[model samples]
Target chain A: MLKYNFKYEWLLLIRNRWIQVLTILLFILFGFAAYNGTQKVKMRTSNLTSAINELQIKEREILSQLDSLEAGHELNISRWMMPTNPVVTGNLLPRVVNMPPKSTAFISTGQSDLFAHYVQPIVTGEDSTMNFKEMTSPTQLLFGSFDLTFVIVYLLPLLIIAFSFNILASERERGSLKLLASQPINIRVWVLQKLGLRFFWLVMVIIITLSLVFIIFDFDIKTNWMSFITLLSIIIAYTLFWFVLAFATNIWIRSSAKNAITLIGFWILFVLLSPTLINQISNTLYPIPSRTLMLNEMRSIKSEAIKKQDEILDNFLRNHPEYATNDSKQARGFYQKYMATQQLIQDELKPLLSEFESQINNQHKLVNASSWFSPALIVQNSLNQIAGTSTGDYQNFKRQSIIFSKEWRNFFKPMLFKGEKFKKSDYKNLPEFRYRYASVNTYSKTFWLIIISSLILFLVLTPNKHQIELIS
Target chain B: MILTNNLTKSYGGLTALDALNLEVKEGEIYCLLGANGAGKTTTINLLLGFLKPTSGRAFINKLDVVEHSKLTKQYLAYIPENLMLYPSLNAIENLDYFSGIANKSFNKKTLQSILTEAGLQESAFYKPVSKYSKGMRQKVGVAIALAKDAKVLLLDEPTSGLDPKASFEFGKLLQKLRQKGVATLMATHDLFRAKEVATTIGIMKDGQLKQQWHVDDISLSDLEKNYLETMSYNTIEL
Candidate 1:
């Protein structure tokens, strides 16, 4: 019976033009989404490359200047602008700390639009006040990018509903259900086989279309084959979930219109309402300190440190007497006082920064704990993880960059306090920033979705007295 | 091969079929005639196991319909008033699917032959059923029953809106099935078709069987007159 059902259902769907229409629709949707995603990735890569090239050019110019000065040539530049001054070199030639986009970054635009891809962290810049968000259109942030994740999470379920909401009700409306019920087969099994075949065909269509889109877009599938396979698995599992809902509705609802309405209602609840409600609830429960208040507090601390810089340096020298040189001829410079004040400002801002961190962490925990209420949220999070553009990824980059900034500042600190000259050879030992991705378990959410879909399918297949009685 | 013993069905305070006892044997055609809201359709539904009887039992080939609903369907084929096949499928394809659901599989050639044997035209066999008329669709339904090798048939107003020539063709198809030793119980308001095809006839009114006859013993005019009298009597009594 299953074999026959599969054979005939394929025939019927083809003859009805369902397969052809679906193929064309999926191609258009996936093709456009892939194009958008790849465009965004290209822009990000270009920005990072340009920044690196600019930094290299500056370094070469500085090295040439140092060569001229060592040769005792009278340079056109001012004494303060000289590369022999460590303070001048350190403040002018900052390293570009960047987070390179991952191979699967094109799959989701996630938080990429909300944050900066690279930052030039200078020695004088405060680590606690590093601006990670780049300049972006507020309107663009309001309406997110139409990447592959958007197509899969929001539009795919609607197509499934349109394809399957009428499976059994249409038969009953056309008067064929009487004949169907008369046959020596369980109506539930028949509905299941029919929906199952449709789901199989739909999954095949998605795979083919997505593969074609990827090929056309020159997406590097060979190197990222595992990520691609995980993506396909997530899509197929999500499709199965929608198909199971369609099956349940077709069996229980008596009219095609009502079934469609009910399915659309479920879509609204799961895709639209659940994620928004969860976000709102998490925000309400674990509120973070206001950004304006933290910024104002940081500014006040920096102003007070600047006024007391001489005292701060005296206290700093008393704490670290090794930096108190025995040569009375060593004169204290402006950088020495500024560095001490920067240290004092950082120390003063620690408690407020920790409070912000704790509150934000609590919000993330709440969101993660409640994400199970919506599969849309899980898919969104999983896609972001695969792309390495999640909030956690950016936070990791910021943390690493901050530590490197400290090392960059400390490297110049000793030279400034001891009145040592900066040289071309010193460039070799300058600290470089490297970004790492946060670890993610990509398959667990997909596994849970499959399990939930299977459980629903089991419940739908289980015969109940009400269903039988309703059939009669 | 089909029998009902004191089968009754009712809604609260309203009986749809009242203690209806009837038997349809192999190689027999029994036509049940009645007006709207009569027990003819209810009896057919009960016999098909689509509706469980409130009291008593229905059997197909000595297997109780309610207890062995799935097994009983193996020996029976049904056609309702509007015999709808998958509009996207052709006559042959529709026959193949319906027969397949009854656990019968046949090659395309066999399916086409079955459609032809059921009186569907050769040209119409490959055309989509969406383009088919009422009579053409009914022929496909008959093709399905023939392919299943059904021992019994339950039809509810199967020829409600068919034209005269189509109606005559349908009667001929029933006569052919009757000769194959199929027990048929059909519910209809067409007294003429009933007389032409039935070996035995029953007239029902207001959920009760009011009259029974052997088709050989009653003329078509007599059957019509008796049916009208029974219907008008109920109206008069009310």
Candidate 2:
């Protein structure tokens, strides 16, 4: 029975040349998106690798020069010159801990465009300036990429709705509903079979397109397994949601034109309007603190600590009495210690940072919970999370920035306090930053919540066997 | 083999079919005659299970139309006034699609023969319906009903838009279906066609059946006069 239904569906679809054209167009778009994303990943990885190697060579040259100067008894002069060269202080090299694109990354570009490519860690209280512009332009961020994820989450559902919204209503309008109803199969089963056939076609296209992307990109097979599965699951559930909606709408609407219009309106509301509206509301609810305000606060703390350097030093010495009887030169070097004190004050403002971050996270939680009503938004959020290109990724970078600051302060403090010359061997001892990828398990609750909600909605909205009510 | 007892349908406040009772036996051509809004279409819709009666029971072959809808549908075929077909498909394709939905599959030769038997021209059988006339579309509809091998056939204004020649041909086709033991319930305003094809003719007015008679019991001219008088506001003491 199912085979016959499927064959019949294919015949109908073939007979309607518009559907065939639409299917071909979707396949082409999928291929194009995957190709572009793979190229972007390869180009970015190559650029970062070349930059890192060049910076490493520059660092080696500076170290050799410092060694030569030390042998000629010019150590003090070389020490003073170190701060002028960014390479000597390791400030030029960005601590880029990249979460490289997975095999399915092409499917959803997500927040990759909006975020920074690499983050550079600075020594506490040095320069205190942030670069506003990076490699990409703001225009690119605003006009997001047409990646695989965008195709699946935004475009695919529309296609499904367009194809399926009038599945039954057209029959009704054309005076064939009675003929169809007179058939041996149940109405609900007929609708399911029709939806299943279309979904089968859609999934086949997606699987083929993604498989091609994987091969072309030479994606790491073992590591990207989970991301691939998540991508597939999201696509399936998202498509199913739209199919079910079309089914429900067809049952209620009396005319094919009305069904198409209403379903398209629903598609626009959920996919396009809801997420954008929620994002705007969230931004208003938890506005990120102005970068200027944060910079001003840091500057004020630094100047205040510098002006009362003697008092701060006295307090520190009293607290750690073991250091009180050290050389007077150590005590007199309060100007050198002022930067560390200012860093301490900045660290103390952590509660304020937490408050701000918590507000944003709360807004995210609100949006995530609201996915019960809009499956498109849920699928989109899930895709972004799996791609490692969300706001959460930025938060992870911020945390890594703090860790890098601590390492930088520790690396310099020993040399500055003990009055020892910085040697080439010490450079190897400096901590290198590495970013840890958050586990997909963090989103398990959200994933299940959306799945359960969608199922519950399907069950609730679906009519019972005994109750056959014509909507019009 | 179709029956309705006190079948009533109302659209919000207006009653389209009011306490209407009708019975169609196997091999019977029951023609329901009425003016506009006389509940002829509503009766056909009820028998077809397209609409539920507000307060009555409708049965097809002893199976309740509402309770055993799928089973009832298996015994039925419906052709509406316009006989709309998938415009992109030819007559053969349209017949195949409708029959396929009813789980009936026929070979190309059998389908062509059915189309020919319904009086569709050989040249137009393979051409897309976008070029087909209203009569050609109705012939395809009859071919679909023939392919289904339905026990009951329901039609709404079956010959409303056809020319006299086409109407005569359709009346001959309905007679052939009657000989095959298929009960047919048709709603039409064409009194002359009804007189030629129907075994039993019923006149309806203001959502009520005013009269029912076997063709042998009433003369054609008297039936036409009675139908017109029943439709208008006149005192007919008969």
Candidate 3:
């Protein structure tokens, strides 16, 4: 029976020239998206690699100049190696760590474009303002690219609906339904066979397209196998959801035109309207703090901490008795240093930074939890997490930047306090920024739950046999 | 065989088929004559299990039409007035689709022969039904019924748009099916054709079957006059 249905379905689908054209167009689109994604990833990787090499050469040249000037007892040439010099600081090459696109990254570019590729800490009091200049734009961040995930989640379902909405309704309208129903099997079996055939075709298309993408990109297969499978399963379940919707609509609607209209309405609601509305509602519910407010608060903390610099250093000495001394001149020398002021400012502003980060995380959590009502948002979030390109990545990056800032402060504070000259080897020992990619295991639960819920919805909403007969 | 025991159907507050009882036996040609909106089409729809009964029961070949819908459908075929087909497919393709769906396997040659047997023109066999005339489309409908080999056939205005020659030819096909013991239930307005072919004639009015006559008992002219008077519609003034 399945073979019979499959043969007939294949013939019918191929017979409709429009459906054939649509299938070809979808294949072309998928190929175009995958190619575009691969090229973008390659371009970024090349640029970052060359930039890191050039920066390393400059760093070595500056270090050599500093060493020669130090030997000659010349302060002007040695001063070029100071942390205050932007060229020296920029050439330090803060680890140059990048999250390269995985095999499935082509599937969903996600938030990779919105965030920065590198982060470095300076002697400034503001940690939030320390990211690369290239990552600060808001316009490109809002209007995203047309990635593979967008094609699967947004366009695929529409195509599925167009293919399946008239499956049974058209038969009835053409007066063949009654003739078909006068067969050996029941209506349930017949409809199930029809749906099963279409599902088989849809799955074939998904597998074919994804396989082509994998083969063409030659991406890392070892670590990405699970993510790839998860994406494919999600695609299947998502397409099935639309198929069930179209099937149910076919049963309820009397005319082919009515079925088309009703199914398109459903697509628009779930795919387009729901996500937009939910995003608006979430923003209205929990608005993020303005940058102006954050900056002003940081400024207030900096001023207060700078005013109490002597007191803060005294407190630090008391806490660490090993560093304490009864020699009044040495202690007075440490208290009068400029580095002591920077340390005092950082110590005071740590709590403020923590509070700000927590508030932003809380906002993210609200959005994540609110995604239950909109599958589009859930899919988007899941894709971003898989690609390691979400707002969460930016948050992690911010935390890393703060840690780098602390390391920078610690490295210079002792030198200034003890009145020692910074040696050339100290430059090599300076801390570098490193970003850890979030593991897929962290989000496996949410992903599976969404897939299960989508399947349940597809099953629960499919029209029953008796209802189909009556309506048809 | 088909049977309805006080079958009733209502749309909102208006009754379409009001406690009507009917039975059609094997090898019997039962023609129901009625004016527009007189419950004839509603009765056929109920027997086909398209609409549920408001009250009472309907059965096809002793199987309850509602409970054994699939079983009942297997024993019946329906031909609507318009005989719509998939406009994209030719006659042979349409026949193949419907026959395959009905689980009736037939080769291309056999299907073409069946279309010819149904009196469809050989030239139109491979042409899309969209280009076929009303009579040719009806011939395809008959061909579908023939392919199904249904035990009972239900038709609505089966001869409405056919020419005299085509109507006579369709009557001959009905007679042939009746001779083979296939029960036929038809709702039609053609009184002359009904008198010529129907073995049992019934007149329905206001959702009720008001009169019935066996062809053996009533004269042709008498049956026609009585049918017009019972339906309360005059074909000829004065």
| Superposition error at A305 for model 3 (Å) | 3.7
List, residue by residue over A1-472, the lDDT tens digit for candidate 2. Answer: 4756776677677788645676577768777877777766666567668767776887776677667755664444554356333323645333454445544555566666655545555544332333312466768777778777778777887788777888777776666655556556666667678877887877776666666656666766467777777677777767777776777676666577888888889888988888878877777877777767776776687677777777776666556454444587555464345644754566555565566567868887777666656667777777777777666666676566556766776666555545455666666776777767666542563466446546745773566633244412
lDDT, model 2, position A44: 59
Query: Quality of candidate 3's docking, in CAPRI categories?
Result: acceptable
| Per-residue alpha-carbon lDDT of candidate 3 for residues B55-157, written as tens digits (9 for 90 to 100) | 9999888999888877787778788887887766789987877777777889999999989888888889888778988788888888888888888999989
| Model 1 DockQ (Cα-based) | 0.77
Model 3 achieves a DockQ score of 0.39
Ranking by lDDT: 1, 2, 3
RMSD to the hidden true structure, all candidates:
2.1, 4.3, 4.1
Residue A290 of model 3, lDDT score: 75
The reply for model 2, stretches above 4 Å from the true place, is: A1-4, A35-47, A70-79, A82-109, A122-136, A182-189, A213-225, A276-293, A314-335, A347-374, A441-472, B6-15, B18-21, B90-93, B105-125, B232-238
Pairs in steric clash, model 3: none
Candidate 1 lDDT over residue span A143-215, tens digit each: 8899999999999999999999998888877778888888998888888899999999999999999999998
Question: After aligning candidate 1 to the native by TM-score, how far in Å is the CA of A148 from where it should be?
Answer: 0.8
In model 3, what lDDT does residue B218 have? 89
Pairs in steric clash, model 2: A107-A148, A107-A149, A108-A149, A182-B73
Q: How far in Å is the alpha carbon of A355 misplaced in model 2?
A: 4.3
Candidate 3, residue A80: Cα displacement in angstroms equals 5.3
lDDT of 2 at A345: 62
lDDT of 3 by residue, A335-412 (tens): 333345555665666776667666667667877776666666666777766666667766676667667776775665
Task: Give the runs in model 1 whose Cα sits over 4 Å from its true position.
Answer: A328-331, A465-472, B233-238
